[model samples]
Target: MILWLTVVQIIVAVAAGAFCLVAGLVGRRPSDFSVGALALVELLLVVQVVVAIVAPLAGNPPTGDLLEFWVYLVSAVLLPIGAVLWALMERSRWSTVILGVAALAIGVMLWRMQVIWTIQVA
Candidate 1:
């Protein structure tokens, strides 16, 4: 995984998580901004996928089991999609909570991706 992009994902995830926590307490519903966050996550995920596909072509190459990489990769790609679905279901503060979970989950997956890369490199 690209370190810079992963860093971005971590930061965004943390922000989204914090947003959710704060929103849940205020008794306010999630807004379009929540969906916006999910959208951003999806955009970043797309970038990562592009990186994954192009890295090998560029000769930088993935440093792990291709199948496992793909598994995590697909999950990473799906998180935002799930978030969108969750948000659709939850129009209230609960949606933010769901988004928070999605963000945290994506961040964890990103960390896992790094770990996988390190293991493969070793």
Candidate 2:
């Protein structure tokens, strides 16, 4: 995995999370900017998935458990979409809160993924 890419993912995820949280706090429903930011996060996650697939094939596999890593990656990809769907259906400030929580989850997951990628194989 590219180190800087993971760093970027972490930063974007945190930013998206913060965006959602603040929107929710302000009693705003899911707006275009928030949704766009969520979409941007999802796009980055797609890039991550592609990287995860290609890097290993190119002999840059994660040093930790591959299955665990893939599971995290898959969850990372799905989380924001789920949150968006839930927000759309609910259409409330709480929905924005859910999105915020999901984004934070993605950020934590990315951090864990970075740790997994950098771990030394014993």
Candidate 3:
């Protein structure tokens, strides 16, 4: 993955976390605003998926535990999609909790990506 792209994702994740925290505190559900924020992070993740696929094709296959990397990537992307769906169905503060979970998952995924990258480099 491109380093700058990871940085951008970090920023997006942080913002999403803040928004989710506020939404949780205020007892809110997903709206255009919350969904829009998640969309920004999702966009970054899509770019990451593209780059990750291309990198391996360009002779940069991951040297880390390959299964771990793939699992983290797939799991991270799925969380937000699930959150969106759950939020739509719940229509309550629980929806914000779903977003909070997504935000937290993103942060964990970011760290896991770094670990996988470092393992490859080492």
Tell me, by lDDT, which candidate is best. Answer: 2
lDDT of each: 0.77, 0.88, 0.78
| Model 1 lDDT-worst window of ten | 113-122
Error of 1 at 102 (Å): 0.6
In terms of TM-score, the best-performing candidate is 2
Arrange candidates, best lDDT first: 2, 3, 1
Candidate 2, position 113, lDDT = 86
Sort by TM-score, best first: 2, 3, 1
Q: Please identify model 2 stretches exceeding 4 Å from their true place.
A: 120-122
| TM match of model 2 to true structure | 0.95
**Distance from true location, Cα of 59 in model 3, Å:** 3.9
lDDT of 1 by residue, 25-79 (tens): 6765777776777778778888888888887787766677777877997997887
Clashing pairs in 1: none
Write model 3 residue lDDT over 1-122, tens digit each, in one string.
66677777887887897887688779887788887777777877888888888987888677678678778888878878888888788888868767876876797797778678655653
Quote the positional error of residue 45 for candidate 1 in Å. Answer: 0.5
The residue ranges of model 3 lying beyond 4 angstroms of the native Cα positions read 120-122
